[model samples]
Target: MNHGQTAPEDRARPLSVVLAGGGTAGHISPMIAIADAVRRSRPDARITMVGTPSGMETRLVPAAGYALETIDRVPMPRRLSADLAKLPGRFSRAVRQAAEIIRAAEADVVVGVGGYVCTPMYAAARRLRVPIVIHEANARPGLANRVGRALGGSVAVAFASTPLGGADHVGMPMRREISQLDRAGRRAEARAALGADPQERLIVVTGGSSGAASINRAVAEFASSGRAAEAGVRLIHITGRGKEVLDPAGSPLSAPGYAQRDYVDGMETAYAAADLLVARSGAGTVSELAATGTPAVLVPLPHGNGEQALNAHDLVSAGGAILVPDDEFTADFLAQTVAPLARDEDRLAEMSRAALTSGVRDADEQMAARVIAAAEAGRGEGRSRA
Candidate 1:
């Protein structure tokens, strides 16, 4: 039960880790990336993921080749209501379920990437006296990560200015496809993969895993307007599953210079191929754009705690991207601003350079290192208590 060993051979067994996060691609993607990093560094390490049964993680975690454990979701109510009254009972049950999962996994460290599943995971890890490592992907910390931090979890943030105290700026952990992409070198191939002519100015639009209605309306209208075709711009629109745009005839949308997809599996190709990306400014999207040096027109999700806007601040301030409010990001803006900007090679190149200047491409490894260290420290503390 020695806790302070640097080498694997000094320990009785390989490290056992449990990662908790889900509900969206933002949380799950980073969690998976960190797990991959940890596995690469320590192939013998055992990794398990904990998420709510109904979260995207059920499909994503298994698809990523990790073991997954599910617990009932217990979202904290924001206001004084019936749901708020039931919170304690739900939270307690979830915590008990989480504790069983952690104990069964024999987790050395519990890593969380803020989501609905994390609060209970944090509570469970604390109860087990296991070290908790948290990755806060938003500039405005979520309630779960805030609670984890207050419980003395080692906190890391995607944004340097995140409000969490004593948090390290680790950027966002992303899949290697994006993090290691040489955008300039792979541009032609990536464009080809997306069926875009190498010379065509490509604008890639996405509202993340779940499509944004405002963005869909604006972009779809712009696409149907035929301006993009007239200007020789090619567009790839990922409308999210079941959120497809429709025409006035009440049929699926079809427009010149527009390729609509319900989803795209590997976004790195899109990042590489896109001359300009039009997307919501989630922390993950912002980090990917910066990492890949992709110029962008960011439309923050109009709702939420204003975090999406804050997430885009650094890149926008650095001249890597343009931020448009949801209300203002209209088809007119696309035609007037984004379409013209897409054709401006000089401006796009300059923006790409600015993006690269602020990019951090090694966050997965950085977070993995933090998790490993926390695991060792936790083990040492266990030895001391024993």
Candidate 2:
């Protein structure tokens, strides 16, 4: 044997972790946050991510400086259809692809944040004897995460009411910027960065990454009403990609004290700059609001499984946020509710404190520790088998 050669038994394997989640920022953001946490704690850890080939992860995971593997988008049908007839073959192929990735990575543990790829990844991990850990970001668990939980994994949830049995009630994992933000200290800087008037209270409105047409229309109408300007408020409207409101002249809409952007790269600065927020109550948004103590007027999406309403319920009840029905979130609602709320310094401060009380800033570190522990346990099991 070569002098440089070492026995396999003497070589220590670095921790191998495979994370799966994608499609929406809600899933992918937390997945990446947790991955960052794991790396901070275990620098030698080899981390890989899995997502559907068509999901947002194709762009985001690579941008976050992590290796990503893709599989087919195997959506389980809620109702029988032609797609359902083709599900078996598609799912089988995806599972095989997932298993191959896991084997090639020598993944000691699989952590799924909930998405289309998660069901197959969970199944493959189970078949491969790799330990699984799950983080469910919504109050109502999704089908894939529910399946993962049933298949027996350590489960964590952003909300205590998530109904994933035995799930540890860990809050949502957020990127370092949002998690560590000192809103008060950075308020002036953040406002300056966004080009807001330092003396005026700023309201940041976002419809999440994909944008919301109704919210955009309502904000444009509110801008035309001039109520926000009259109240000495400034507005940063994140209209989402391709969803900008336009005037009769086909130019983007404009009003005094109103600024519009299709997107903001770092939402933490937006959260810091806002005295008030108007946005949908996606799990990620709610958690970030609470974390940064940015009080919000939340408009839940009218469609979907009604999880958005459920996601905002606790924060609204906590007096940290307000919830309005989608159809009722009109210009008048903004003038009467959000604009006035923005101008009320004392009330805004109270809501900010309440939001902070409801937030969890350490979930990323907490989830990372849990994931690493699961991986270590799997390593123990493998050594025992050997």
Q: How much lDDT does each candidate structure score?
A: 0.90, 0.89
TM-score: which candidate is best? 2
Ten contiguous residues with the weakest lDDT in model 1: 1-10
User: What value of lDDT does candidate 1 attain over all alpha carbons?
Assistant: 0.90
- Estimate the TM-score of every prediction: 0.93, 0.95
Per-residue lDDT tens digits for candidate 2, residues 1-386, read 23435335424878889999999889999999999999999999999999987988999999999988999998878798999999999999999999999988888899999999999999999988789999999988999999998888899999866777899988999998998899989889988888887788889999987899999998998997787788678889999998888987899888888989998979988998898999999999999888888999999999989999989977888899989999999988888888889989999999999988888999999999999988877765653211
Q: lDDT at 172 for candidate 1?
A: 92
State the lDDT at 65 in candidate 2: 98
Please, what are the lDDT tens digits per residue for candidate 1 over residues 1-386?
43454334436788988999999988999999999999999999999999998999999999999888999899878789999989999999999999998888778899999899999999988888889999999888999999999988999999887888999998999999899999989999888888889988999999888888899988888889897797778888989999988899988888899988888878998898899999999999999999989999999988868999999998998899999999999988988899899999999999999998888899999999999998877766653211
